[model samples]
Target: MKYQIRHRTHYRYTQPLRSAVQTLCLTPRHTDTQHVHHWQLQSPTPLQPQTDAWGNHSHVLAVGAGARMLQCEATGMVETLGTPLQSDPLGPDPRLYLMPSALARADDALRRSALAAVRGVEGRQAQALALTALVAECVRYQPGRTNANTTAAEAWLGGVGVCQDQAHVLVAACRAVGLPARYVSGYFHARGGPELASHAWAQVCLDPAERRWLGLDVTHGCVVDERHVQIAVGPDYAACAPVRGVRSGGGGEQLTVSVEIIPQD
Candidate 1:
């Protein structure tokens, strides 16, 4: 499947001041499952592409003073291939993902949740599917109830959150069950109703020997497919956020993000 993607992020400040420096993880990586044909990032500030420790392509954007509003847009064409039922993990040691992060920490309740998920599951793949289902069942999808910093345990306790929280919860639960899982940020084309084009999911290592990674979407209760365009992978959302930064003087910031993904003929 091929897709054309456009994403625009805009920010407004109450008080304008000097410079701002931001890290951008908006560029998609070419992998076994996906290939980037043409991609470009547009912003008022100059963008210098750099690869992070995790092999994600990042852009450092530096904006000089005097602009009250900043806009960043990314447009691209990508071809996504279906993962064969078997494949090797492409990056660093899988154990790196087993470690808990600030937002993906597992608690006693999360441990219990993990225990319940794999109670009768016979194989690792079955256990992973069960765990993903358990997370979806435990946390109802509700937006505006939590913020970006909300942890997996906190969202589980509330029983409501967005895709980001769902991915976090799934990551934490998988780790609790001795599975190495990491967070994935990407773009998804929604058919109808209400759905954010920008999406988040989890990839769990099912077979370290074969280096198999299984992509799971607890938010929509489905396995990630060609419809999903991979952007970045990390311990949690914070690491793969599309844009993050600090400014010398930008008071009371308001941000808006709009994303669209269309299939190509």
Candidate 2:
């Protein structure tokens, strides 16, 4: 499956900004499942491109003073292999994903729940599926109940969150049980609407020795397929956020994001 994606982020500030620097993880990743044809990133200022520790394509955008607004756009065309599971023979050390991160850390209760979910699960893939089902039951897909800063424990306790929270819970749960997992940020081609087009999921390392990973969408309780586009991946959302930034002076800001994923024949 092929897709043309466009993502735009806009910021409006009441007061002009003195100086601002932003880290962008908007570029889609090239993997065994996907191929990038052409990609472009546009910003008011120049974008410095580099690869992060996780091997993600990243950019640093800096804006000078006297700017009341900022806008950034990323457009690209990618082709996905439509494979439900991924096998990365050249992936980074699987142990890196074993460690817990800030947003995806599991608590005692979460660990116990994870253990219970996979108590008798036969294989790694089966255990991962059980964990995915557990997350779906534990966290209801309700937006506005949690934000980006919400942790896996908090979301599990609240019993409501969006895709990000669900991903965090799945990642935390897998890690709690000694299974390696990481958060994946990307675009989902949903027919319902664009509300969930900007999606997230968990990639559990089924076999570290073989570098095998299974992508699970906890929100939907299924394995990832052609509809999912691979973007930056890391321990959690903070590491793979599309845009993260800091500004010297920007009083009261409003942000708006638009994402479009169109299927191509």
Candidate 2, 149-227: lDDT as tens digits: 9999999999999999999999999999889999999988865555445899999998898888889998777788888
- Cα error, residue 258 of model 2, in Å, equals 0.5
What is candidate 1's lDDT per residue for 1-265, written digit by digit as tens? 8988899999999988588999999999777788899999999967898988666899999888888988999999998886623243456787888899999999999989798879878987889899899899989999999999999999999999999999999999999988999899998775554545689999988887777788898887888777778899889999989999889887888989998888885
Q: What is the lDDT of residue 216 in candidate 2?
A: 94
lDDT against the true structure, each candidate: 0.87, 0.90
What TM value does model 1 have?
A: 0.93
**Per-residue error at 229 for model 2, in Å?**
0.6
Alpha carbon deviation, residue 115, candidate 1 (Å): 1.7
TM-score (C-alpha) between model 2 and the true structure: 0.96
